[model samples]
Target: MESVALNPATLSGPVWVVAPHPDDEALGCGALLAALVAQGTEVWALLLTDGGFSHPGSRTYPRVRLAALRLEEWRRGLQVLGISPERSAALGLPDGALAAVPPEQVTAAVRRAFQLAPPALVLLPWQRDPHPDHRAAWEPVRAAWNTPVLGYSVWLTGRGAAADWPVAAEAQVLTFDVTPHRRTKAAAIAAHRSQLGLIQDDPSGFTLSAEMVDRALTGPELYFRPYGQSVD
Candidate 1:
């Protein structure tokens, strides 16, 4: 039962999640986030991208309007999972353009998220995810490694996406098994209707490309402390 943090404090106060995109939240830690909210955690989700590249027909739609639509998708999705709009932020960064962003801008965003969140446990994508968004999303919250940084995998499955970050940092990896609550998790994911058109068009196309999605989450959750405090 060491899979999830059983302490009520496990979900207490101001929790922040840095997602590569809107669906990452639901796919990565939907159950945990829901469980935390069910226990009363003030959760904030900082979505890094607008998911602009997802629609093959996006070229026909105004980028700004498309961005706005995706933001709404996230809004509805979070609501289904119990997260308020005030608790969520959509940066709307250009999709597939993260690696091209200026370093200053990336650092500034990360610095701001922490300043605003002051999170007890900052959640982010497991560094090894295949999606570039997942990799680039690291820009903003990476420095918070000094605090408790929990890496959630939406790509790698069997046991969650494995963390590729060096073990020289003070980071923790926790896995939440949502099999019992898969319906809630899946419903939360379905809230992103605009973004899931491929699956919407064909539900059978739901592939776990993120790598973290295939790793079955276990009970009590799994936590890995990366740096082990030696770095500090």
Candidate 2:
């Protein structure tokens, strides 16, 4: 897909990034977030899940404790991207179960978060992102605030099917180079210690592989702006 280079200075703010999980924002759009911040744009974050499901089998870090730690890690990552903790909100929704939640309920929660800091532009996972939670998060965020949205890619490169990608007629593909902000993006991703081998007890627990981290740091971050959308 041919993509135009995205210049952060051209984007308006305050921008709100809606992440389905704690590390998603960092993994997906950390460099863009950092660039926006450096451009003096106000960036806000809305985390959708409690992020406790990743290590469900660990007794040392139960769901409740794991959730709290993940929340803290999220805030730390946002801070690294120059977004203050006060500018972020977490819905505390159950991780890995968003698909089962009623859409109206999720939309209502997303609306409440928007009330805190109304966004000029919103960033969310692509509507057809590979992960179930990421895919499920799309509509509620769009319904909550009828604003301009740029869908960021999380698991798209590694896991997305052909249908998962936005077609040329559907979206304007844009890419932001991360080379300048590689270190900052890396640090933001590293803030999620639990997802990066901090949890030892659960053998089945999730841990970001070196290959995944390297992939994230090396490429240009892609954003898709849906065609034929009017932003009020």
Best by lDDT: 2
lDDT of 1 by residue, 1-232 (tens): 1232334344545778777777777877777778778877788888877776665344444556656776887888788878888777766677778877775677677667667767666777766656777777664557643466666666544433345432434454444557656667777777766654533332433334433333323332343434443211
User: Residue by residue across 1-232, what tens digits does model 2's lDDT show?
Assistant: 7798988887888899999999999999999999999989989999999999999999999999999999999999999989998999999999999988999999999999998878899999999989999989999889998789999998998889899999879998989899999999999999999999999999999999898899899978988989876323
How much is 99 displaced in model 1, in angstroms? 1.0
Worst-scoring 10-residue span by lDDT in model 2: 223-232
lDDT of each: 0.63, 0.92
Best by TM-score: 2
Those runs of model 1 whose alpha carbons end farther than 4 Å from true positions after fitting are: 1-12, 58-62, 144-146, 158-173, 198-225, 229-232
lDDT for 72 in candidate 2 is: 96
For the record, the alpha-carbon RMSD of candidate 2 to the native fold, in angstroms, is 1.3
